[model samples]
Target: MKKVSKVFYITVVLVILAVAFGAAFPDQFEEITGNIKTFVATNFGWYYMLLMSAMVIFSIIIALSPYGKIRLGKDHERPDFSTATWIAMLFSAGMGIGLVFYGAAEPLFHYAVDAPTSEEGTGAAFKEGLSYAYFHWGLHVWAMYAITALALAFFQFRKEEPGLISATLKPLFGNKMNGPLGVLIDVLAVFATVFGVATSLGFGAVQINGGLNHLFGIEIGFTAQFMIILVVTILFLASAWSGLSKGIKYLSNTNMVLAVILLIVVLIVGPTLLILNMFTETFGLYLQHILEMSFRTAPLEGDNRSWLDGWTIFYWAWWISWAPFVGMFIARVSRGRTIREFITGVLIIPTLFVSVWFAAFGTTAGDVQNSGIDLTQYKTELVLFNMFDNLPLSLILSIIAILLIASFFITSADSATFVLGMQSTNGSLTPPNNVKVAWGVAQSAVALILLYVGGLTAIQNTIIIAALPFSFVMILMVIALFKALSKEVKSGK
Candidate 1:
């Protein structure tokens, strides 16, 4: 039964891939993606936001309630990792590359072109810009992670049904959610994660290459992507083989350190004053315009800026698609944490950290652009190089950039591989280490294929396609979560 189900899922994914690749020409891809963006914004925009908001609120309630206990098992054992370390590792694993890639640039770009929620005028424009990033990185995004993670931890550790999304939904559908429905959910998550992280991989690879090129004066080419993937595969496979006790724990710890160093460097080098000021204002603007902004799916009108349509709308979809993987990772790491704690850790902490990074790095990038640096002439591979070109001690900065990009990529890839393995193995919540290694290698191969084929577009399209079904599953997941919570409370778990 499982074999048949897996084959059916694979067939469906292939059909979807064919459709995406069939539109590989630049114009065709844009047109199709554009139409998708419009459809999402027009019809499903509010639904997505509302869904995210409810998850966030429930997470907050869980954290505050004494009921949502993080346990190693149903019996409640010792702490796995320190709270601080666990939170850092979780954040690094959860959002890693995308957070870095999108943080500063997203808000700044929104400010320049205006998001859907923005009113006319510079003041409103800046407010709208900052708000978009906040929403993308804010409570809603974390809530998605919280719900998935909490569901997994509760179901797998507590109920012991193999720890997949299908297993999590078993509460609602009883046995029916098994078989095909269960397989469908798991497959959908795999596809979403592949595409989602592939985009991150593409972006990180390009940036990592640019950093290396700038540092060593090497010509930019496919060599960097190849090397980056090679390094990622090696590091993750080693960790996966070593098991979570030795591998994931150590990798997560090291990755956290590298992230801290990068943040400190950005703070020291970038415009401290501007970032501080902008962060305060941006946070305020985000808070002030939170509701209006959350549902504002930039309408496809004659008056809309193509740039806004390209960046903001695309980002929203991208984040939504990536939510499952990121959320699942966060949930995995958040054992023993209350719902409130999980939500706060996933939502608040990361947002604060990302806001700082964006403010510092984004302000610097904006300054470079404003100073007539003209980064637009460069391809994506030159993005980091272009940014560091104007900063002090270009060589040292380039080195730091390379290290940062590498670590982020490695950590994220490893985490995703682990999560994918867990999702697929159909065993315990924390699957056997060998299963983790298997998925990690599969992810690397997928990353290689994506880079080899159509670069970032193919990867991003794949993730989006994966999300289509999962998003609906998520809607059902949300309903199932409430039902489970109610049952627990009534029975007093």
Candidate 2:
């Protein structure tokens, strides 16, 4: 068997053992994972904040530096897809269902509870809520993705290396990257990718179930979530089988159009002026307070520290956990772009789009609540639908929202399956169909098992714990990338 196959089998066995154990001992699994998650968040919350800050700084510095001129591929080469297609794919693969999941809910949560810096339900809290929402989903998260994707693209396209995380770190260990150490790194990458994507899949399942429940009066439970996952698993695997250009790209474009329509409709039908003012004001606040918010930790907040850990720290860890999958997918699609173009596009375009999305949905939800609708009483998964209740064509818009979610879900899972196939198969650009199918099933199985074990809480804990080691790994990748870049510069390549 190939080394990739050996790694694949070993990973499969390990995941199976974990799932079996979790299924057999659900309460114990949640307790143990929950405790570990708390310990890490409590002790290392500062570390996550500092690390994210550094990544954001690094991404900007590199983009503005002389290295900005460097192309990810040969100088004469250009991008494979159109700019529009590329951005759509980037948004779809990176944060699809997540944006939909939190667009309204996150801001409302912050407004209802208020941050350490603001008072609840007041204008101050409202502005702070929108600012925090942008902060969580802003440049910091994409900077993480930019750094990882830059490293992978640099090594793969510039040096003609395999597109694997371990492969990108060849400067650190040299030949050892081809030995047992390399295998171990690849295994860890696979582990992180599976869990991170599974977490998203879990979130998508729950939200999809919630949408159905809101629309058709279906009961919300594990069975419905599992069924949703099963249907989506089939859709995404079929898309994966159809390959990247045909299935993934088409769905990404379609979803992007759908998302834009939804955003425009909400802005027109909802409080247009309030959302516009909220976005303009909150965006300015985000710019002015970016540094302070980026580094804000539980240590500084005194009594309000728990909120920082539960929301900000958790988001940081979740974004880092997703770095491997999103970064790899970005690199795969961004082969022929310059470093400046890649970093600027990834960091700017999507962040701005998310800001607008949050402004439309989040501020609108806040407006509805202030008008006495009280959307906060609903479950987080159903908050978006509940907000839709007060809008024009509620049922039609709800169905459109459901379709958008499903498309995003399919695109995300399809991209994940493709990336996981490459990671497990020695970075083959076109991995075998069987490998893709196996990984698709494995990802769903993990999501289902975690759903049964402890639902969203368990899923969040799993991602936080999985991200810790990979955070260290990403730091090394940054080092290795710079080391290699220095050599290339000296050699005048």
Candidate 3:
């Protein structure tokens, strides 16, 4: 077997000890992490909002600047994947299961259950619900991702640096990044990736369990979700075993097809006109109030402040936690493209796709609730299935939804295993399978531990805690990348 770096052994041991602690003292683990998570959210909610907003602005300026012409690779190089395939791969790896997991649930939550500012189940809430959904899942999420990916791709491909997050900062830190500081940076990234992907894995298990319960009367509980995670862990591990290009590529393209089918079916079978109407109106409102929402701390209103802490703040942390994994995976596949094209495509394509996705599923959900279906009666994980219950071909739609979630579940874990393996192995493009297996198991174990501790809330808590330190690393990465880009322009290389 190949010699794995010290980083691999260190991260594996850390993940194991953390898992053991969570397993041995689940309540204590949950309470401690939960308290820390709340403290971070309360004290640093403004920081989350401001940092995310700044990243979005940074993404736009770089795409429009003269540096936009700089290719990710050598100037003569071209993109590795076709445009459509590239988009599918990035979108699938970026936000696949999230769209299914929250498509109907998030907007509907804001609309009927606990709206941001408006009275629940009112016209005002309806608009605000979808608008907030767009706000959360749209431009900023991708911008956070785009900035991280841009830094990695620029440093790794253009400058011929190692494909590590630490390597991206070498412009500012120089060879010091190759010392203890670099190892610490990579470890934090792995820590964030492990907990972050584990959090998504928890959601996937819950939603899959929710779908099974909704479809076949299976009980929705930790046992069932545990089983769901167990089965998925085996499957995605197999996908990881199959290596990256063949199975993962096929899966990514298939995800897009299935997602498109689901979206069109829902729009056509459900309230098509209403879906279009909400999409147009809410999209406008999302753009109109984006600045307000971007910096909104809601210091005055207790109810809205609580809502910000719960949703907006949580999402910012979630994206930051996800940045390392998603950013690395994206940079891996985004070679040979110009910075402008990369940022614009990574930014716009998914933004438009998810905006329409929310419109179709969320508007239909709101319509269902308006028709007196009481979607609020269902759990968040089960809301989508129940919402489909009031629509045409509900059974088939639910089936497709489950399959999509499972596919995304496998693809996400598969990609994370690859990313973890690379990060731990000094940025090996094809890391040893043994290292991948270690990461794959560790990820699943962490997911199971989180579910055992407190289910979705626990998952949220872990990611929030993991994202904070990495957020600081990302701040430095932006500075390093800017320094490198300026040097590039000056050298005329």
Quote the lDDT for 369 in model 1. Answer: 64
lDDT of 3 by residue, 1-493 (tens): 1457777878888999999999999999999999999899989999999999999999999999998999999999999999998998889888978899999999999998899999988998999999999999999999999999999999889888878999999988889989999999999999999999998999999999999998899998889988998899899888899988876788899899999999999999999988998899999999999999999998884657888988999999999999999999999999999999999999999999999999999999999989978888888899999998888899999999999999999999999999988888888888898889889999999999999988898898999999999999999999998889999999998
TM-score of every model versus the real structure: 0.86, 0.98, 0.99
Global lDDT scores for all candidate models: 0.65, 0.90, 0.92
- Off-target runs (Cα >4 Å) in candidate 3 are none
TM-score of 1: 0.86
Give stretches of model 2 more than 4 Å off.
1-3
List the candidate 1 regions with Cα displacement exceeding 4 Å: 1-46, 61-75, 112-128, 300-309, 429-434
In the order shown, the candidates' Cα RMSDs to the true structure are: 3.8, 1.3, 1.1
The TM-score-based order of candidates, best leading, equals: 3, 2, 1
Top candidate on lDDT is: 3
The candidate with the higher lDDT, 2 or 3, is: 3
Candidate 3 achieves a global lDDT of 0.92
Candidate 2 per-residue lDDT over residues 1-493, each given as its tens digit: 1235556887888889888988999999999999999999999899999999999999998999888889999988899999999999999998999998999999998887556577788888888998888999999999999999999999998888988888998999998998888878878888888888899999999999999999899999999999999999999999999999999999999999999999999999999999999999999999999989987775653558878878898889889888989999999999899999999999999999999999899898898899988898899899999999998878877888899989998998899888888888888899888999999999999999999999999999998898998899999998998888778778888
**Please, what are the lDDT tens digits per residue for candidate 1 over residues 1-493?**
1212362347345545643464355455545654664665556554655666666677777677654554424655444678877877777766777766665556556555444555532556655566566666766676777777777767665565565778778767888876777776777777777667767777787677666676666666667677877777787677666655566677677767776776677677777777678778878877887777555544556546454435544555576677667767766665665555556667688777766666666666666766776654566556555776787666676676667667778777777766776666563445666656655655665565656655666565455445566778877777787677677778766
What ranking of all candidate models by lDDT puts the best one first? 3, 2, 1
